[model samples]
Target chain A: MDLPFSTPAGPDARSAFEASVMRHLDAAYGLARWLARNEQDAEDVVQEAVLRAYRFFGGFRGGDARVWLLAIVRNTFYTLRAAAPAPSAHDAFDETLHGGEDGAPDPETLLARAADAERLRAALARLPAEYREVLVLREFEECSYKEIAAITQLKIGTVMSRLARARERLARCLLEPAAEASP
Target chain B: MNCEEARVLLHAYLDDELDAAASLAMAQHLAGCAGCTQRYRGHARLQQALRDPALRVSAPAALRARLAARLPAPQPAARAARRWPALAAALAAALALTVTLATWQTLRPRAPAGDALVAEAVSGHVRALLAEHLLDVPSSDQHTVKPWFDGRLDYAPQVKDLVAEGFPLAGGRLDVLDGRRVAALVYRRHRHVINLYQWPAADGETGTRERDGYRVVQWNEDGMHYLAVSDAAAADLDAFVRAFRGASAAGAEPAR
Candidate 1:
C-alpha cells in the first residue's frame, strides 16, 4: 500500500505515528484476542498488524486512530487465519439457529446463576465468528452500529440483526443447562 | 408501537440506536408493557455480564514492548526521493553505487574493534529477549527462514539448521546496528537465546568478549560480520560459533 504523502524522515514524525498507533494497542489487542481466541495467536496477530499499520502509516489520513488501527488488526487476523490452517467444525456456527424462538428463562434468575465469567466466555467462544465479532464490537468495544458497519464492512441493518441474533444465541448458550450438561 | 413492533426494535432500543421519535415510543411502550420492559432488563443484564472486567483481556506487557521495538526507523531518503521525482532515479543510481563500493570495502581485511560492538551486541541480545521481540520470521527450517530475508535486507544472512548441535535455528529479523540495518539470525540453546548479528564485515579479525554476564563472540567470514551473543557458557557459545562457521563454509563453497 502506498502512502498518499511522503512521511518526513525524522524522529518527530516517527514518534507521532507511534503515539497515534500505540494509544490503541489495548483496543487492537483486545479485538485480536477475542477474534483469535488465544493469547499467543493474539500476540502474533497484533505484532503483524502493528507492523502493517506502520508500513501503511503514510496512507493514514488522521481521524479516530483506534478505529483505524482496529481495522488493520481485523484485516491482519483474517489474513493470518486464512494462511494458518483449515477451519475446524467448531469454528462454524449456524446462523439459522441463532434466530431460534425458544422462550428464555426468567432474566433475573438466569442473570444471577450465569453471571460466572467462565460460562459467559465459553458461550461467547462457541458463537460463529460472524456473530461473535458483531457482539464483541458492539457489547465489548461499545462501538455504534455505524462504527461496526464500517469495521466489519457490513451494512448498518446487518450489524443490528447480527448483534440481536448474537445476544440471543449467547443467552441461550449461557442459560440452557441442558446444552452445558450434555458435554 | 405494539408488542411485535417493540420486540423487533427492542435491541435497537436497548442500544439507543433509535431516532428520537422511535426512542420516545419505545420508552412509552416499556413503561406500559411489562413483557418488553422485562426483555429490555434481560438485555441490559447480559450486556453488563459481558462487560465484566474479568471477561476482558489486556495486552501483555512484553507484547507491548515487542511491538514498540519493531517500529521501523524513519527513512529520510525515501522522503527525499518522494519530494524530487526527477532526482529519484539519479539518487537510486548513486545509492546502488555507494552500496556496492561499501560492500567491497567491507570485505577487505582489518583488525576487529572491541568494546563498542560487543556492548551493542549484548544490548541487542538483551533487548530482544526482554521485549519478547526475539524473532520476526520464526521458523526452524532454514529454507523457510532464509528466504524471508529477501528484499528485506541488502544481503541475505545464512540460516543454518543447528538443531543437531543442541542449538536449533529459531528465526531471523532485520535489526539496526551501528546506524545500519543488519540481519540477526536467532537460535535457541535450551532456554537461552543466541542472536547472531551479521552485516558486511569491515576486514576484522575474529574476537570474543564477555559483558554483563553474556558471551559476545565475533568473527568475519565470506564478507559478513557474525557476532553471536548469549548468556550460555562461553564453551557452548564457542561450539555454536564453530558449528555455524563450518556450516556456512560448507554452504558458501557451493554458491561460489
Candidate 2:
C-alpha cells in the first residue's frame, strides 16, 4: 500500500493533522451532535467521517482539510442516521437544549472568552436543526455557496436562501429576546 | 434599485459572485435601503461570526489520539470483523447439516473495544521499539520539537527529554490519538511503553481522570493542553513531566 491514507504522519504530519482536527473537530462534533442529538451517535458520526476521510484521502484535493472534514461530517451524519436506529428528536435531557428557548455556549469556546461572548453562541445553539446546519457550514465551516450546494446536495440558490434565512432566524433570535427584556 | 433586484443580488453579493458594476449597484442599494442593509449586515455579521477562530472546537486529547489511530479507517475494520462471524456461522451450518458441530466456537473472535482504539498507537509504539520508525523530527530540544511541529500539526505539543532519570528520547511519530493526527513522542524507561498524546482541547474538557488503571496526566500550558498515558509509575511520569516542562521553560532540549 502507498500509505497515503494511513494517518501516522512523518513523525511531524501527525501533530499537524491532529492540531487541525482538534481545532475543527469540536465544531464538526457540535454540528454532528446537534443534528444527531446523542453523544455516542455523534461520536460515531465523527469516527465514521474520520475513517472515510482516511480511506479515500488520496483523492483529497487539499485546501483547508477542515472544510473537507466538515463536508464529510454532514455526509456522515445523514448516512449513519439512515442506517442506525433513530433517536427521539428534541427529547430535552439538558436544561440548555438545542432549539430550546436558550442554548448554552459550547464550553469549548465559552470557557476562555469574555463574559458577554456566549450570547451569540447560546443563541446559535437554540436555532432549529434546519437552520443550524446551514449556519454552521456557511459561517464556521467557511464553505462557499458551491461547496454548501455540494455538501447539502441542494441547488446553489437554495443554499443562498437557506443561509439568508439562517441569518434571519439568528437575527430574530438575538433581537427578539433583548427587545422583550427592554421593558 | 427595487426589492426584486436587491433580493436577487443579495446572495451574489454575499457570495462575491457579482461583477464589479453589479456589486457597486448592490452596495448603493444596500446603503439606501435600511431593511436590505440590515439583511446585508446580518449576512455580513453572521459570516464574520463563523470565521472566529475562537469558535473552532478543540478535540480532546483522548478523542484526537483515538481519531488519529484509526484515521485511515476505523468503521471498515469493524465491517471486516463482522464477516468472520458470518463465515464461522456458515461453517457451523454446513457441519450441522451433516452432524451438529459445537456451535460455541462459531462465535468469531474480535479485538475488544478498548484495545481496538489503542491498537495502532500501542502497536506503532511497540513496532517503533522493534523497527525504529521513531522521530522523523529528532531532538528533545523544545525549540526543535516546537518548530518541528510548526508546519506539521495545528498546535505545538510539549516535548522534553529525561535521559538522566532513565527515560531516553527514543523518537516521535505523527499518529492519531482519538482520531485526530497528533504528536506521539516516544520514550523508553526500562521496557514500560509511554505514549504522550497532544491535540487541542475540545468540548470534552473534563479534568484528568484515571483510565483503565493507567496513570494519565492532563493540563493546559500556554494556549494548549496535553495528555500523557503510560503504565509506568506516577512518580516517573511526574519526573518526566517536570523535566519536560522545565526544559520547555529553560529553552533547552526537552526530554526525549
Candidate 3:
C-alpha cells in the first residue's frame, strides 16, 4: 500500500497523517476506555498513543488506519497500565470467573436479565482485562477476528479461544446474582 | 459437527467469522439439535447485549484539542514559499473569495426538499450549540427526559436510555424543524451533545447526510421521524442511531 505521507514530516505530511489516522480517534479512545475502565486513565492512554502514532507516522505503511492506530492504542494502554502503582483486579486470574452449569438459569431468563444494561456493564467490568479486551474489540468496536488478533497480538487460535472463554465468563457473571458475582 | 465441535464453532458462527462451508455445517448441526440451538441463542443474546453503544466511549473533545495543540507546526516550506508577498496575498484573496462563494451557495435556501430538511436539522443542531439552549430538561434518566416530552407535541417520541451503551440521555427539549415543533432528545457522547429531533413521520425523506462538520442521521421508526444531529464522529453517530433503535426495540424501559 502507498504510504500517504512520504515527505519528511513536513506540513503536508502532518496534514495527511491527521486526515488519514486521526479520524479513528474514537476507535482508539473506545478501546482504551474499555481497557482502562475509566475516563481519566483512558484519556492518558489515548494521549500517549496519539503521540506514539504521530512520532511513528513517517514509518506507517498505510493499510487499515483504524486497525493500525488501534494496535498502537492497545499497546500504549498496556504500557501505561504496567507503569501504574497498583495492578487492577482485572489483571488477576480468579477461578470463580468460570461459568459452571451447576444450577444455571434457563436461557430465556438469563437472556432477559442480561439485557439490562447495568447488569451487563457490571458483568463485563468484572472480566479479566485479557477477556474484556477481546469482547470489547469484537462486540463494541465490531472488529473482525483478524483485526482483533492483529490489535491484541494474539494468534488467531488464541483469539478464538480467549473470546470463547470471555463469553462464558461474562455469561456466568450475568447469570449469577450481583452480590455473589463480585469477585 | 457434533455438540463438542458445534460448541467450539458457535462463537465464530454467531460472529459470522466462519467460512460458508463451515457455517453451513454449523447451521445444519444447529437445525437438528435443540441443545446446541439453545446454547447458540444464549450466546447470541449475550453478543447482542455486548453491542450496547453505552459500552463504547468516544474521545472527549478536550483531548482532541489538547492533541491538536501539542502537534508540531508543519510546512516550513509553505512558510518559505510565502516570501513571494504579492503573489501570496493574491492567492489568499482568491482563496477567501472562493470560500465566501462556497458558503453563500451552501447557506442559500436553494436545496431540494430532502436537502432542505438536512440543512434545517444541521441548523437546529448549530443553533442549539450557539444559543447554549441544549435542553429544557437536562436529566440523564430516560424516565425524566421521556415524560418531559409528553403533551408538548402531537406525537410521542420513543425515548431510550443509552447510558449503558455509552451515550447518556442528557435531556429533552422542544425544537422547530420544518417550521413545526419537534421533540428533541439530548444525549451526550463524551463532550459531544447529540440532538435527536422527532415528530410524526412525513412522507419526504430518510437517510444520513453531512453538513457543516455535523452529521445528520434521519430515519423513520414506528410512527415518528427522527433526525439525530451531532458534531461527534460519523461512526459514533451511526452507532448512536443503532443503539437508540436497538434500545427502543429491546424494551420501553430505560437502560439504567
Candidate 4:
C-alpha cells in the first residue's frame, strides 16, 4: 500500500503549519460563526476548512495565513450551505438599494440603537449573508477593502458597495422595529 | 463635492479606501456638512459596536483539540532523510532499518495504565496553555461551568468551586485522552493554570509525577479518575490536591 506521506517538510511542516495557522483559529471561528450563524455549523465549517488547509499546506507559499485560511473557511461555508440548504436560504433583502429610501429613519436613531450591543448584534444577524459577510470582514475583522475583496473573491468595487448596503440595512434594522418582522 | 456625491462616497472615505484627492475632497465636504458628519459618526459608532470583544467568541477548546488531533502524525521516512548521513547503499539500508526499529520502540503502544496516560494528560495541559485555549465555557461560577458539560458529555463531572480554597474555578472544556473523551476543568492559582481531567475510573490508583517541569497528580474518587496537571510548584500542587480532595469529601456544592 502506498502511503501518501511524501510532503517534503515532514513533521516540521506540521509544527510550522500549527504555528502559522493555529494562532488564527479564533479569527477563523469568528468568521465561520458569523457566517453560519450557529455554533454547531460554524464548528463544522472550521473543521472542514482546517482539514483542507492541512491537505494543501504543501502549496501554501507564505502569505497572510489568516486570510488564506479564511478564504478556505468561507468557501467551505458556501459549499456546505449549497450541499445542505439552510432554512433561510434566500437572502431576501434587496442589495441594490443605496443609502436613502422612503421612510428611512435619521442616522441619529441608528446611532442611539447602535450603542446597544445586543441590538447591534441582532441587526447584523438580520442582514443578508452577502451584506453580513462583507460587514464582518470590513468592520469586525478589520480587513482592508483589498483584503475583503481577496477573502470574498469579489472586486474591490463590489466589496465597497456591499459594505455600504450592509451598513444601510443595519441602520434600517436598528431604527425600524417593524423591519424585524419582514423576514 | 456636493451632498449627494459626498454621501455616496462616505463609506469608502470612512474606510480609508479613497485616493488622497477623493479623501481630501470628502474631508473638505464633511467639515462644512453637519448632517453628513453625524451620518459618518453613526457609521463609526456602528463599526465601534461591531468591534466589541463580546461579538467574537474564541473557538471552543474541544474543536481546537479535534483539529490538532486530526493532523497526520510525523512519518518515519522524513526522520530518516534528516539524520542519516549519505553513505553506500548497503550502509544507508542498515541505517534505515536502525531508524525504523528506534521509531517503532517510541511509537509502539504502552499498557495505557502508566506513562502513556500521564504523557497524554501532560500534553493536553501544555497544548491548552500554548494554544491559549484554556476554556470553552469561561466562567468562575461552578454552576455555569458544570451544566456546560450536559449533552456534551455522557456523565457530568463534579465541578468544585475551589475559590475559597485559593484555586478559583476558571472554566471547563471537553478533551480526549487515551482515546476516550474526558472533561477538563480549569482552575487558576494566582498566575498558574490547573487543568483537572476526569473520566470514569478504569482501575483505582492514585499517584504524583513531575514531567517537563509540570506536575501531574492522579487520583480516583467517586468512580472517577482525575488527573490534575499544572506547571505549579510541587508543594503548591500537593496543596491543591489536598484542597480538591478535601472539598470533594465534604460534598461541597456552592449555592447552585
Cα deviation in Å at residue B63, candidate 2?
A: 1.1
Candidate 1 clash pair list: B110-B203
Docking class for model 3 is: incorrect
Cα lDDT tens digits, model 4, A1-183, are 423222323579788889999899998998999998989879968976886676556567789999999899998888766644234744766556654564434666777787788877877887888888998888768899999989999999888878877887788778867645644
For model 4, the stretches where C-alpha displacement exceeds 4 angstroms are A1-9, A86-90, A98-107, B75-256
Cα lDDT, all candidates: 0.72, 0.56, 0.73, 0.74
- Candidate 1: regions farther than 4 A off: A1-9, A97-101, A178-183, B2-4, B73-256
Q: Report the candidate with higher DockQ, 1 versus 2.
A: 1
lDDT of 2 by residue, B1-256 (tens): 7866676478679879677998999999988887777556555655566566665554456656766554322232233236433223222222232111111212325546444334334433433332223455666544455566664565667666567767777556665544455777766566465667666665324234453344566655666556666656778777767666665432443334
For each candidate, the DockQ is 0.31, 0.09, 0.20, 0.25
Chain A TM-score for candidate 1 is: 0.88
Model 2 has fnat of: 0.14
Q: Give the chain A TM-score for each candidate.
A: 0.88, 0.57, 0.88, 0.88
TM-score of each model's chain B: 0.55, 0.42, 0.56, 0.56
- By TM-score, how accurate is candidate 1? 0.61
Best by DockQ: 1
- What are the runs in model 3 whose C-alpha is more than 4 Å off? A1-8, A94-99, A102-105, B75-256
Q: After superposition, how far is residue A46 of candidate 2 from its true place, in Å?
A: 1.2
Writing each residue's lDDT as its tens digit, candidate 3 over B101-168 gives 34544456597888878876765565444323456687887767776766555566788878889998
Worst 10 residues of 4 chain A by lDDT: A1-10
Models 1 onward score TM values of 0.61, 0.44, 0.56, 0.57
Give the distance in Å from residue A104's predicted Cα in candidate 3 to where it truly belongs.
7.3
Each model's fnat? 0.45, 0.14, 0.47, 0.45
lDDT of 1 by residue, B1-256 (tens): 9977776588888888999999999999999998878777887899888888887777899988777654534543454356534333333333333333233334535535566567656655654553345678988878778788776666777778778889888888766565455789988776567889888776754788876567888888778888898877788899999999876532444433
